[model samples]
Target: MSEFGRENPQFYLTAPTACPYLPGKYERKVFTHLVGEKASALNDILTQGGFRRSQNIAYRPACEACKACVSVRVRVDEFQPSRTFRRIIKRNADLIGEELPPQPSADQYALFRDYLDMRHAEGGMAEMTVLDYAMMVEDTHVETRVIEYRRRGPDSGIRGRGRGPLIAVALTDVLSDGLSMVYSFFDPDMADRSLGTFMILDHIERARKAGLPYVYLGYWVKGSPKMGYKIRFAPQEHLTGTGWLRVEGEDDAQD
Candidate 1:
């Protein structure tokens, strides 16, 4: 079993399946349950070692012949937004994000369905019903939250919360080192706002305020157009075989 502590959590490996990110290739994962009193501490350790938490399970890529899925985390303290990133933030300045308990809502599910239908229509999560979406948000053992973004209202300045329809949602985990973005979805109609990038920028600021140094952005696969946007956040670290290494250049060829 993988080393964590004396508890010795049982580990398992999944059968090979077609990789969604890289076509014509298959992938596998090694995972273990994150339950019991020490779940939060164990999650922090596993996450730092490149494992991502999905519900109560912590998993990492275990492909035998391929290692394209490299874990990435933004160095929040060192991050300086580029001109393009600043523009995206400015465009989204009218919205406010509020961290809420891991509670499911009808509005969240509706936005999730729209996002899947537009962005990932043929993906695995496209067929998920409202119940599945609820489980995805509420079924967690570690410290997790749902950050909802909405249009700012007149009382937002005093209440620190937005009003009106929910435009975006981020299902995030609060690790000791930083925030781990498990999943995020935005209103497809707001494509011009670049909500995806804006959410990441907001998370960076949140981490900074919390005195956290990193913002884990999950796996970044080489040659995948969908994941290429992740590299735009400079001075980020990619988990290599040797350890976490700092990458600053905007070259996708290095991966």
Candidate 2:
């Protein structure tokens, strides 16, 4: 009889586990499945409320005594690219991104596997199989798109899609406020380009072009080196206790 309907989403709390983002701290999550006909609408509301989607699950950190996972989103219109960000764009000038339907491909799976093996070998998703990868891309009922990045070729102008080997892929959700980058992966060998940062810069630009006000970047955990780069993007807003607070000093430890 709850508002979630017959296919009611059953919420559960994860047992406390070693924090992946912080040392000597534990982390927990409150999660629910995002399925059924109302999935898309439910997803939108949850995302705005700081939940992140993975496959068919919507989860948000719910640590008992810690609130280190702060959701941050860039205000696209007000974002001014730093010199480094501009250089990143210049360095990747030969690349092109094509937005396509959420269909799984062997090439994508290969790249995904390579990324996991090289970057997140010990992470939870390292054991994901090909079928799991497919479900990750196709299990969503929300408005999603896969952006494939590749090098430009002779026929690039005509086809509009890039032609080199698949270097990166981003699973994005189109929302009323902005685009949510659910997950993205790049070739680890191309570390010099800093593809991870480059992708984020690209998304910011993309949001601007699309006339969206913000580009949701999931969460930023303070004291976590892996998540430190997120603070470098100036003019970002963090979801604080008082609501979305404009963050000025990158050193402010909200998370």
Candidate 3:
């Protein structure tokens, strides 16, 4: 029996599929639905145990003969922005993040499509339709928020929200201890702004202000270039056999 309640959540295993990060490796996942009244509690527990929530499902890597995928979370209070990170913050100083309910919009889908087409044309979600994207955003039982980043406008102070077109978007979950970044995408054309790093930095600040201790950053795969950026956030903890082991210093990966 699991710790959640008298009846344990039923788990399902996914068939082996080509690993998106590492070549010559296959990946499998053990997943369970995140539903019912206890969903938020279950989400918090599972995430602390290294499970990542997608839509209404919470999943973890259960690949056979491999253990490269590691869960990571940033220590919000202790994290100080590096010189490069500082520049990224200053670079996007005009931008503001507005947290909205988990609702989808055509504008968001357009930006999402552009991001996928440019950054991940060959990725698994490349073919996701607008309706599919809606499900991805709205299909959740836990406390979820869709944060849209855009440029600050003239009346920004009064409105408390950004104006103009959306520049980036992040799907986040509010956990008892931290914020989990389920998914995020930005305008590929604004790559110079380093929006990805900016979003993480923003989340850390947001979590800190919310009195959260950590910012769950999903997984960081060893030797995978796509996941290398995750190691840049210092004072982060990696989920290991002995539980979350804290790591210091930042990896110098290309910005």
Candidate 4:
């Protein structure tokens, strides 16, 4: 790990497991550990090269004979919201997003627990304990921020912090190319507001304001309905065998 080796970080592959996105398929991952001062730089290179971060680990799908997992990103400066997206934005108008230090608290953990129970009960992160949640928030080598979305409170504008029950949370990484959404979750009961889409839209706007050109949306699985929303953001780029290509006029293009 000491030698830069053209800035290549050490990599390892995980054992095959049941693929959550695509049924009857096995999925493995090629991953690496991000630690020390160079971790941030390493993370940026890995993300640009198709890896996604979960805590200190950077990984990407490596299923044999399948390439359905394609990295996607919204061209922030050129993004045009669809009519549905606009509606979602309007629906969540009462919520205020406060960008705060990446420090996990009891409230965030409680919301995280509820989100996992409601949305991903059978998923891999279903069993993450409070300690795990804290590490997920605070254990980082890159520049990260936690954006907490809550109902507008009287003192929200002055204090710049959410006071009501947490409705949504996005742990984001500030990268040179764009803002990479490391992970995001919201109250599943509030599905009508489409908090998932709202968070992505917010990230796109935030990126545009910061002069970044893209908002990395991680991977979009071709046949996974759970991942279908990634295609809704128009004028996005999908990383293909050739390179990043603009998605054309398909409403729900798969990865």
TM per candidate: 0.95, 0.92, 0.96, 0.92
Off by over 4 Å in 4: 1-8, 154-159, 249-255
lDDT of 3 by residue, 6-47 (tens): 236888899999999999999999999888788999999999
| Candidate 1 vs candidate 3, lDDT winner | 3
Report the lDDT tens digits of candidate 1 across residue range 67-185. Answer: 99999999999999887888889999999999999999999999999999999999999899989888888888899989999999999988889999999999999999999999999
Winning candidate number (TM-score): 3
Which of candidates 2 and 3 reaches a greater TM-score? 3
- Sorted on lDDT, best first, the list reads 3, 1, 2, 4
In TM-score terms, candidate 4 sits at 0.92
Error of 1 at 9 (Å): 1.0
lDDT (Cα, 0-100) at 63 in candidate 4:
82
lDDT of 2 at 40: 85
Best by lDDT: 3
Give the per-residue Cα lDDT of candidate 1 at 99.
90
User: How many clashes in each candidate?
Assistant: 0, 0, 0, 0
| Candidate 2: worst-modelled 10 consecutive residues by lDDT | 246-255
Measured with C-alpha atoms, the lDDT of residue 4 in candidate 1 is: 51
| RMSD of candidates 1 onward, in order | 3.0, 2.9, 2.4, 2.4
List where candidate 2 sits over 4 angstroms from the true fold: 1-9, 249-255
